[model samples]
Target: MAGPALLLIALLLATLGQAPTARAEPNVHIYAAASLGDALDAAIARYEASHAVNIVPVYAASSTAARQIANGAPAELYFSANERWMTWLGEQGITLSERSDLLHNQLVLIAPRKDDASSVALDKPGELVARLGAGRRLAVGDPAHVPAGIYARQALQSLDEWQTLETRLARADNVRAALALVERGEAPLGIVYKTDARASNRVSELATFPAASHDPINYPLALVGTSPSDAASAFREWLAGEQALAIFQDFGFAAATSDAH
Candidate 1:
C-alpha cells in the first residue's frame, strides 16, 4: 500500500509538470477601406471563431486609411481599395514585404429606389444630373483622393457631363458616406462600389460604368510595420486563403487573381 501511494504521488507530480501552458490572447489592429466593411466583418468573424486573437478594424477611405497607418496609427494590417495608396504607404516605410492582393471592386451608379426614370445604361455614362428634377442632388466621393470618386469623375468627364453636373455635386469624404447620402434620398444619385450598392436596401443600382471608364479597382492588403501581435500576420494569411476569397465573392467582390495589380 505504501509503494502504491508513492507511485501515485509521483505520477501525479509528473502529470502536473507536463500540463500544457495557457496561451496569451493576441491583440490586432487593422486599417481597412470603407468599401470592405461587410466582407471584412464576415472574414474576421470566421477567423475569430478559431483563433484566440481579437481584431480591431478601422474603416475609412483607402487614402485616409493609408494616411492613418503612415501617421503612426497603431495598425498591424492595412487593406486599401487601390494599390496607389498601398504603394504610397510602402514608399513611406509603413508596409511589409509580403503583401497580397485581396479583392477587386467595380464602380457603379446608384440611385434612390424612388427615382423611377433614372435607369442608365451600363456602357453609357450616367446623366443623372441632367435627368434630375429641380433641387435634385448628385453624390460623389471626393474625387481628389477617393478611388471610387476618382473613377466617377473620370466617367463623368469622359461622357462630357462633368461641367454640366459640376454645380449639383455633393461630395462625401468616403464612398460609404456618399452611398448613405443617396440612400437617405438627400442625394438622388451616387457613385459607389457594386458591393456597397448590394449591401444597401435603400438604394438601387442604375448602371455599372464600363471598365474602360477609369482605372481598375484593386484592393491590396499588406502588413504594416507596427503589427504589435502575430495575429495580424495570421489574419493576413487567412485573407489569402480560399475561405476569405469565397466570403469576398459572396459580397460581390471579385477574387483577386495572382496577376491582379
Candidate 2:
C-alpha cells in the first residue's frame, strides 16, 4: 500500500513541476514536423492553458528531428508528417510506444501570388517545368530525407516531370523552408503542404498533386524517447483526442486515424 501511495504522490509531484527519484520529468517536449508548426503551437497553447504541465514543442523536418533523436535528443514525443520516418525510428528501437497516425494533408505546388501568372496543368507532364518563369528553380524539401521532398519527387516522377526539373531543384531543410523560399520570392515555384500555403499570404496554390502520385500523407504521432515519462503519455493522449483534432481541422488537416497502427 505504501509503495503504490508513493508512486501516486510522485506522479502528482511531477505534474506539479517536481521530479521524484525516477525519471520524473515534469514536462513533455514534442519534436514535430515543420509543416505542423503553427497548428501545433496553437494546440500547445490551448493545452497548457488548462493543463498543469508544460508541453514544449520543437519543430523541424521529421528527418532532422528523427536523426537528432537517434543521436539521443531529449524530446519526449515525435509527431511526423510521413510514416516512413516514424517507421525508421521504430526500427531503431527508439520509440517508447503509442505510435499512431493523427492527421492527413494534401501536397500542392505553389508559386508567388501574382496577377498575371498563367495556371499550369498539373495532370500533364512538363507543365510544371515550363511554367518555371525566369527563376527556373523549384524549391523543395531535401528529397533524400524530408518527407515533403520525397512526396514531391514521387509526384513529379509519376507525371514524368522529375528529369526535367531535377537540375532546377532548390532543396530546403524542410517543407516550410521550401515554402519560405517561394514566399520570399527566392524561388519561383515550390512544392508544399496545402496547410503551409494557407498559412502564408505571399504564396498561392498553383496545383495539387494527385493522390496516386505518392504515398498517403499521414501525420503519425508517437511517444519517442529512451526514458518516457507519465506526463508525456498523458499529454499524448490529450493531443490525440478531439481537442487537438479540432485545431488540426482548422488548419486544413483531415482526420486519418481510422487505420492507425
Candidate 3:
C-alpha cells in the first residue's frame, strides 16, 4: 500500500511539471475583396503548404473592407477590387506599403443557367429591358458604393441604357451577392466580374462588357499598416509572383499589365 501511494504521488508531480501547450496566433491577416474569395483561398493554401506561417483572410466588398481598415480593423494587408477604395485609404493616411495593381477582371452580364440567351448585344438600347420581361428586375451590386456596381453603372451609362435600367436594379451588398441573385433566379440577370460568373456553375454569362465602356477593373494589393509583419510582406510579394498569378489566371483573372488603369 505504501509503494502504490508513492507511485501515485510521483505521477501527480510529473503532470504538474509539464507546461500547457500554447495556441498559435495568426501571423498575417488579409482583407480582400469578395470577388477574390476562391482564387485567394487557393493561393493561400498553396502558399501555406510550402511556407511556415499562419494566414487568415477576410472577404468583403472593397468599400466595406476599406472602411473596416480605416476604423481600426486588424488587417495587415488589403486587396481591393478597384483603385478608388485603395485611393480612399491613402487619402485617410493609412500608409500603404508596396502598393501596386495585382490583377485585372472584366465586367460581364450573366443570367440563370436555365436562361437560353447565349449572348445579348449590349450596344443596342432597350434590349436588356426586353429580356427582363415585365416587373422583373436586373441584379447588380449597389451602385452607391460597390466597385462592381459602379462599373456596371458606367457600362450602362456608356451604352445609353442607364435611364431605362436604373430603376430596375435589384441592388446587392457586393458583386458576389449580385451573382448569387442571378444564380438563385431571384433576379433574371446580373452584372458581375467575369471571374465571379466563372466561379458559379448555376450562372451563364450573357455578354462581356466592352473594355472601353467602363474604367479598367483593377485589383490592387498593399500592406495595410506602416509596419506590416515580415510574413505579411512576404505574402504580398508572393502574390505578385508567377505561382500566385497562375492560380489567379486559372480562376479566370488576368494579370494586371503596367498600362492597365
Candidate 4:
C-alpha cells in the first residue's frame, strides 16, 4: 500500500509547551505491537509516577493494532514492531508527521526450557524439520498478519526449511501466543522475538536468525492523527528519553532508533 504525502513531524516536548490539563487526568491511550509489552509497561509506570497522567496500552499483533487504529479506536499513539503496519497507518492518514523508530529486536527460535533436544543451528538447511520428526510441530504467529510470523517464514525459506515446516506449523494470533504453545509443549519449538524469549523462564533460545534472513525488526512510535493532547505528546517524547532507553535495555531491546534522537 502507498503512504499519503504528509509532513513527518518531529515532536520536541521542551519547545512544544506543556499539555493542557483536563478536568480529570487524561489517560494517554497507546495501541502497540504485543512484543512491546514488558519494556513499555515499565516505562509507563515510571512516567505515571512522575506525571499525573496514566497510560493505557493496547497490545496485539502490529497488524491487528494498526487495523484497530484505522477503524477509529481512541488511541492517541501507535507503536508498531515493524514499519509495514506503521506505513499502512500513514496511508490511512491516521498517523501524524511526528514519528520515531523507537527500538530494535531480533528473531529467534526457542523451545521448552526442560526439553532434551539439542540446539539446532539455523545456518544448516534441513536441521529444523529433521529435529521435528514425523509429526512434531513448530509454532509461530500467523504469518498472514503477525510481524514475527512473517520474519520467521522468511528465515525458514532462506534456510530451505519452509517447504517442510509450513504445513506443520501451529499458528497463533500473536508471537507471545506462539511462545506459549512452545512453553506448554503443545509445539516442540516456536519462533519469537529475542526479547520475548528472555522474558520467559519457560523457554530457552535454540538459535538466532541471521539478519540476512529477514528485514530488520524496528519499533516505530507515532502520534495518531493531529493529536492535540499535551499529555500524549509529552509521553511520546519521554519514550525516547534516557529513562525509557534504560528500560528498553533491561527488557532486551537495543538502543533507541538513531534517526529519532
Q: List the residue pairs that clash in candidate 4.
A: 8-97, 9-97, 9-98, 19-230
Q: Estimate, for each residue in 1-261, the C-alpha lDDT of model 3 and write its tens digit.
A: 999999999999899889587666447999999999999999999999998888899999999999999999999999999899999998998988788898999999999996456788887778888888899999999999999999999999999989989999999999999998998999999999999999999988999999999999999999988788888999999998999999999999998973322
lDDT tens digits by residue: candidate 1, 143-162: 88987888888878877788
Residue-wise lDDT of candidate 2 within 116-233, one digit each (tens)? 7666798765577778865579999999999999999999999989987888899999999999899999999999999999999898898889999999999998887656788898
The global C-alpha lDDT for each of the candidates, from Candidate 1 onward, is: 0.83, 0.88, 0.92, 0.87
Enumerate clash totals for all models, in the order shown: 0, 0, 0, 4
| Ordered list by lDDT, greatest first | 3, 2, 4, 1
In order of appearance, the predictions have TM-scores of: 0.86, 0.87, 0.89, 0.88
The local lDDT score (0 to 100) that residue 210 gets in candidate 3 is 98
Which one wins by TM-score: 3 or 4? 3
Candidate 1 ranges with C-alpha deviation above 4 Å: 1-21, 115-118, 122-126, 226-229, 259-261
**Model 2, residue pairs in steric clash:** none
| Candidate with best lDDT | 3
TM match of model 1 to true structure: 0.86
lDDT of 1: 0.83
Off by over 4 Å in 2: 1-25, 258-260
Q: What digit string (tens of lDDT, one per residue) describes model 4 on residues 195-260? A: 999999999898899988998898988888774499998998888788899999999999755554
